[model samples]
Target: MEITNLETLPGKQIIAHFGLVSGSTVRAKHFGKDFLAGLKNIVGGELKSYTDLLNEARDEAINRMLNQAKSKGANAVINVRFSTSSVAQGASEIYCYGTAVKVS
Candidate 1:
């Protein structure tokens, strides 16, 4: 499905609105990754391990949201947004949401 942060998709007209759709995932830092991250922090560089984890989590959340929109007969999702929050001491939640719509 076409997903965009804009309220409207270029060259496409919204035919119907299916309210809101959302998906979320909670992920915890792996011990091995945490150890690597700590070492990277000491050197003050990018933490590849943690960065990969977040990227995967974000993709999963977006996929789930797209599935929900598809199930609702939506061809696209507009005004897509993402959020992140600490769910626990070591766990974080990634959420994606948007307005499901049919466009043509």
Candidate 2:
């Protein structure tokens, strides 16, 4: 399916609007990674562990969003957006949302 942050797809015409669709997931850092992050903080470098975690979360959220769009019989999703928030001490939420539409 085609997904874009813009209101409309570049070459496709939006024929039907199915309103809003969304997906989200929550994840927490592993203890080992937490310890590594602490050490990295002292040395001041990239946190690869956390980066990987967020990347995986983003993919999962996008897959879920696509599943929702497909279930709605939509060929595309427009105005796609992502949101991240801390829901707990070590856990964060990843959310993806968009307007489901049929394109032709």
Each candidate's number of clashing pairs is: 0, 0
Per-model lDDT:
0.92, 0.93
In order, what is each prediction's RMSD in angstroms? Answer: 0.9, 0.8
lDDT of 2: 0.93
Residues forming the 10-long window of minimal summed lDDT in candidate 1: 45-54
Write model 1 residue lDDT over 42-88, tens digit each, in one string: 88978777788889999999999999999999999999999999989
- lDDT score, candidate 1: 0.92
After superposing candidate 2 on the true structure, give the runs of residues whose Cα lies further than 4 Å from its correct spot: none
Q: Model 1 shows how many backbone clashes?
A: 0
- On TM-score, the candidate that comes out on top is 2
